[model samples]
Target: MDTTTWTLEQVKDRISKGQEIDERVVDIGQNTVVKFADNVSAEEGEATMFIARMTSVPVARIYAILRDESDGVTYIVQEKLRGEPLINHLPTLDTATRDALALELQKILNELATLDKGHMGLFGRPSQYGSGILAKFDPPVPPIESPEDFLRWLPHNVRDNYGRDEAPLPTGIFDFSRPPIFSHGDFVPENILIEDGHVTGIIDWAYAGWYPYFWNDYIARRRSTLMAFQDGKWSQMVGQMMQPFPEEFRAFQQLYYRADSLL
Candidate 1:
């Protein structure tokens, strides 16, 4: 299956016909897979490939990035990785295996933390469209440089869109002066691939970017708590692997709630 030859209509049709499309990439009856990004610029696809190449962490091999001239949608062809998502197997793993997996996760996180672009903001270059929280708006918000700036930006942006006359007050005082670190914004088990008790690759780079040092740990811990019921060995291992930052976590939660209230 030559993905470069596939048209947007054909891809949509195939998807509608029950083909498995993983993160915009579909396996077109061959060993190869094609990733599609629609109604957006090519920045994200380009950034994902760039980050994959730059990082030491295992990731899918990107063969090429193609764009449809008529619609400006991007397509990425890459090697199909061989592994199951860790989330699917976590429940069956013994404590020892789970602990080993947590160690591997910690190592990956540490390596990612070593990646610093010397400034604060989102991971990729500044563009009109971004992912994660930024994608919630049209003409996406600009990458923030500081936590305080983000704190102010959140309420202002939310209120602006909601036609509110005033921004909400902060629930608590916080110092967001810490330097930014590389963050896999959506760092959950589902993004991790494993085979034979070893991590094979990490996928879904759409939300990778520069964020506060505590952001990755906080989000990962929060998700582990949610997915693992806050009592399982998986949750315990995650807590051990990543230290908790209750203050920052609470602040972010409050900000998120305040912003969500406007909607």
Candidate 2:
């Protein structure tokens, strides 16, 4: 299970040779799992591990981070978590269990909010990853100082090209200001683990970082829409758990659509 000196090619070769692969980790036929940080930057690995260690949320324990000196890729070996993702069981849960899950998630969200860095913009380094293709503009999205700054930075041409003409940007939508808070950038059912009606862990911290207060709600709403389209009951259940921010959610939806259209 020792991959302290493995390279990206070496890891891939091992996997191709039938090494056990589970999500981000590659089981090297031993009692350990090797989580490869491929396509993710070193900073992301560092940030994820940092947040995992600091937060009370149940996350995989990091054993070590091995870097390939030649290409500078990072491989994170960590403990494999048990339990199925929340998405798999959401459909079977009754109302009471679902409510309990929601309350637990709310507590986790509140805790995450307390870990804010007091800054704005998407979390993580811009250099480590491109603005998600779904929202990249010409000048590129920068660290947001305020909601006004975020809206102002949207390229006019990009907006004109993909924006919904009927639903204009809400009046004074960006005028309001709220302090930045830590956002689990991609908080969806798939990232949450549950066993016997209790959440065991919340995984995936690649997008964990400080963002505007409304970002987490916005993301949950967006994911809820996708879930609704797939399963109405599940959608309604999740909506109840993670409330909605209608006005801001719609605003962000439009903004993301326009920005993402460019890609």
Candidate 3:
């Protein structure tokens, strides 16, 4: 949409009556879509805009971010990707196509890795939105400086379940020195858009931020619904595409499995 000609108020009005593409998304026009909701992560717009500025990353181009402060709703208008979600085409994809996509993912992850500025939260400062990693918290966890800090912040119940031998999250394993890398937190097929054999856009960046590299692998595997589809080959593909932090991931799995207890 043309942000120059349309005001935020106008966008808000249009979104209120827009044709629903899904629960929170609307097809605003032939070339754009609008994602609006009271709980939409504000950082998603920033993430998309940031990725749009990067030459290598294939992400939706955010046109405008309008927050209706009075109603606590946020509207993000962004480019409509040319293709459908990778999930839709995964079953039909050939090995060659999947391999190409894997290579593309490797490059995208490399681009994200370049953003190691030591920030351990969202891309920018003072992240108010809850991430997938800590969404169970009522008020949400804030940015932390170290992995130990994150471990200390874990709920006692989940903490108690962990063995003393675990690294990163457990107290015994000591070295928490890995610098946080920028991650797309949710790297499942549904967030990936593919046209032909190439990735056209990576959307739904609500969980995108700086975190341990393992977060990508663990979260991708943990959150993936690909088990029923392709017999879990997609998850295996993601494991190969991202960094492997098997030790840290095994520890994290225990905590994540108990995440609902925090609620």
TM-score of every candidate relative to the true structure: 0.81, 0.77, 0.85
**Residue 102 shift from truth in candidate 2, angstroms:** 1.3
Question: Which parts of model 2 have CA positions greater than 4 angstroms off?
Answer: 1-24, 29-32, 69-72, 122-131, 134-143, 156-169, 227-229
Output the better candidate (2/3) by lDDT: 3
User: 1-263 in candidate 2: lDDT tens per residue?
Assistant: 44356556665565565455566656754344566544555545566676677778777766566677766556765666777788888777888898888888887887777784744544455312234652444445455676555554554435554563322355756435566667777888888999888888777676776665677778776776773347665556546655456787787777767555554
Best TM-score among the predictions, by candidate number: 3
Query: RMSD in Å for candidate 3, one decimal?
Result: 3.9
- Local distance difference test scores for all models: 0.67, 0.64, 0.71
Q: What is the Å distance of residue 24 in model 2 from its true position?
A: 4.7
As for candidate 3, its clashing pairs are none
TM-score of 3: 0.85
Clashing pairs in 1: 123-209
lDDT of 3 by residue, 1-263 (tens): 46666567777677677788899998877677889899886678988887778647877777788788888999888888888888888878888889889889888888878864556665564333255536545444555776555655555423454332222245554247766667776778888888989998888988777776577877776655445554766866776688777677767676655554434
Which residue segments of model 3 deviate by more than 4 Å?
Answer: 125-129, 138-143, 156-175, 224-226
